[model samples]
Target: MATSMRATINIARGMDGAIAEILLGAVKGQNLAAERLLALSAAEAPLDSNSGGTLIASGTVVPAAAVGDDSLVTYDTPYAARWHEDQELVDNLGRHYMGDSNFQNGRKSHYLVDPARENKAELIAIVAAGVKRG
Candidate 1:
């Protein structure tokens, strides 16, 4: 005669629960990282002495709600998009215009985009830090 043994294993949580946890962690991590990215991009943003530095001050981060959702990093000025696109007019409009602040150096055009691209790796790392590979 031959005998067989059977065993059962219980996961700490169900698949759906595990997935939800991971998504929560990722969302939190993304939000945490978004702050730093926003700050960096803002610092890199072209400083417009005109309009009281509106472009530099408009850097914003709209965080992701879910794993598949994209977190928006944007500026909230009317000319933000045009300025970011490196339009010549945006450049000439600055430089201590009337009530605006003095011209600022060390800022660059395409400021937000460039920093985001360069720091992509760091962003991913920050996101990854919240999840564990199974």
Candidate 2:
């Protein structure tokens, strides 16, 4: 036996255009925030701590504009970068290296969160500016 379920739902009529406009504005705001974060994170990331600079250099902000979602700014780096950002590790020689020990124990450089927090007001302003312009 096989079973399937389907449902139809209705939102208020004539809301499509309004909803699309709101979504576009939100996306624009998100893109602006991503741009700011990219710049701030790159500038603030600890460069001198890494031997090769790959960790700081790999920092990136994937703008929500490309993904069409406000929450989709993907701050990313290579897999090994996590150890550089947040962990104390032992090398083959049994030497311990502290990764960003100056900050919180679990966080290093905070390339993403710190910038977002520091620029919260500016991010809000970007949204407001977009709304006003629209």
List the global CA lDDT of all models.
0.73, 0.62
Looking at model 1, residue 134 earns an lDDT score of 17
Task: Report how far off residue 121 is in candidate 2 (Å).
Answer: 1.8
Every model: Cα RMSD to truth:
5.9, 12.0
Pairs that clash in candidate 1? none
Candidate 1 lDDT, tens digit per residue, 1-134? 89999999878659888888888888877876787788888887766666667886777789888888777788988767755665434245565323232225767667788888999899888878766531
lDDT of prediction 1: 0.73
Off by over 4 Å in 2: 1-15, 48-59, 65-80, 91-94, 101-108
Instruction: Give the least accurate 10-residue stretch of model 2, judged by summed lDDT.
Output: 66-75
The local distance difference test score of model 2 is: 0.62
Model 2 residue-pair collision total: 0
